[model samples]
Target: MSKFFTYLALGLLWLLHWLPLPAFVAIGRGLGWLLFWLAAPRRKVVRINLKLCFPHLSEAERERLAKDHFAMVARSFLERSILWFAPEARIRRLVRFKNQERFDALVGQPVILLAPHFVGLDWGGARIAMSYDCASMYAHQKNPILDKWLLHGRTRFGDQQLLSRQDGVRGIARALKAHRPFYYLPDMDYGPRDSIFVPFFGVQTATISGLPRLATLGRATVLPVVTRALPNGAGYEVEFGEPWTDYPTDDLEADTRRMNAEIERWVLTMPEQYYWVHKRFKTRPPGEPRIY
Candidate 1:
């Protein structure tokens, strides 16, 4: 099934690349509607996540957040598609940087650039690769056409791409050894072994341990970054936070928990912007039922 989707994605990539800019955006919007409004996989997932995260919010508020989440998802998809095919000048014009010099200072050092799953995340990753040799891990989409197209777009700025389930540590080590920054979405669930249960949105949720592991192995500075969508529905603000000074203890589980907690802290700053579509609480700890 994955192979079949790969083939389909390849075809879509061909069609999308050849299409005019407006046409590409049209196609993107259509796909967004299907996935976000009609099919609504992410919206459904987010609704469950929101209910868990904001239990105190009224039913009407939860419903509003769910609807807003879907709209944000749709807007993000279309803007990302535009980034894929748009000219470099156009992309630069749309995406602005705030407090980026701090990030620039860490270029030579092995850095674990942490980014939330926001609207312009791919573009932010691309911007990093363009400035410095960088590698990022992306979850493989079921649609082959979409996956290939996404990889093609991500690698366009000369950064290598790694699948999430691949030898993530090894790939990251190679990038670090070469003094290239390694990027990954630390908020999502990886698997039972690769993750640890941590407090998120007032519940213990499973989160990938890659950030802590990578930071420890490479002695990398963990920098939190977020790319927020602007009101015009076209531009972005790529904001970078200060690096984490605290190091993990000898215990892996404790360190993982600390790392996930830091991520949760930053994510709540713009809770509405989080990629709530993810099944964040998919893997519960022993004796606990899955939250979603």
Candidate 2:
């Protein structure tokens, strides 16, 4: 039954891909509002995240932001059908690169493509995968069938290498030395083991120090990769921001904080598209209470 349901959901998504792009925006907004009401736990999480990050925003403003965020989340989920099954030409049509020459200029050198958790993050990664054989890591999903599909869709183009989390930093280091652009997703609360309590949006959030550590280990340059799901049905922009000059300095914590700071700046531009639904502040300081 689980397998059957998985296929059924995929089938629905496949059908959804055939619709006009505007329909995704409209349908996603309606579906997102429905989910905003129905998915209580997630709505709470989003609310908490927004409150922590945007402390200045009023209750009603955050309330509206949360609803709008769900719409982008739903739109991203629904658009996976287009990403997974659509032709290369169609996918290319939907996703474009800004400052692409900068990305191209980095060819043959190791780079850490630092992508943060935006609703359009996956689309940006997919855009990169369409052209380059990038390497990135993933936590394995519990369902084997779904896991297979996830990987299949991710690696369909560019022969990209999606290493399992267990592969560890060794896998990433090797990929970097190979001169492949490492498609790295940096800002996430992956617990407190290898993470340090860094100031994210002025909140002491558990942020992974892997970005600096890996860059230092791999001797790679760090590039900020941001994706904006353009308003309406125009398309998505996978923008490669200017490379950091003095990154991975002696201070690991400070480096990670810089990463968080950059992400926070970008998040302000499109607050709704940021991945606020995640329990980013779930891991608190030793004496501190949980934020979620």
Candidate 3:
């Protein structure tokens, strides 16, 4: 039954992708809002996340944001699918990078590209790697078929995909030394493995510290970048933030805290766009029991 539904969903999605861009965009936007209100599991998750993060917000306000979030998520879903299936010419027309040379200059250097869970950031990474050497570290999705398809689509532009866990510390280090840019989404909460609790939207959250440690150890520059959703069904803004040249200290924990702080600042700038549905504070702080 599950497999049947999966194929049916995929078939419909393919048909949607085949439609004219404007039509697909309209349908996708509508579907996102529909799912936001109609899907029980998604609504529950969104509600829980919102309630936890914005305790001060009225229930009505949180519900409104959750609805907007669903719309954005739905739009992102269609946009990303289009990103995969859309032709190069159309994709190029969709998103543009400012200060691309800053990225261009690092074509030969080992660097960590920190992308928060913003719109089209993955698309921006793919575009950047087309002209330079780059690889991205992503949490492997559980569905084997979807994972395989995603891997093929992402690497179609020449960027390598590094599975977050399987790649291990050594593999990532090797990729760094190769002197090509590495892409990592900074907002994911993987586990309690060497992470530090940092203030994210005034809530203490556990975050992955691998990027800063790798940058400091490998002597690589860490550049903060975000791809924002643009108005209309067009492209997005691939804005590059200031690069981290100073690097973190030898203390792994201190460096990790600093990295989390930086990522938190970026997410706060665009609270609605960040993947708030994720249980970021799932991992409990020391001495506390698990909450979710």
Please tell me which predicted candidate would have the highest lDDT against the true structure: 2
Query: How many pairs collide in each candidate, listed in order?
Result: 5, 0, 1
Candidate 2 residue spans exceeding 4 A from truth: none
Using TM-score as the yardstick, the better of models 2 and 3 is 2
> Which lDDT tens digits does candidate 3 get at residues 154-265?
7767556564667676666778788767787767778888677876666677877777777876778888888776665566778887787657666776666777777668
Q: What is the C-alpha RMSD of each candidate to the true structure, in Å?
A: 3.8, 1.0, 2.5
lDDT sort, best first: 2, 3, 1
lDDT of 1 by residue, 1-292 (tens): 5777656744555455444334534454556546666765666788788888889988889877766666566655645555576667766766778899988888888887888777568768766666666777777887666777788788877646564656657777877777777776777776687767777777887777777778888888888887876653556678888877776456777777776666667666666667888787788889986565
TM-score, candidate 3, is 0.88
Instruction: Encode model 2's per-residue lDDT on 74-100: one tens digit a residue.
Output: 998998888878888888998889999
In model 2, what are the clashing residue pairs, if there are any? none
Superposed by TM-score, candidate 3 places the C-alpha of residue 254 at a distance from the truth, in angstroms, of 3.9
Candidate closest to the true structure, highest TM-score: 2
CA lDDT, candidate 2, residue 50: 88
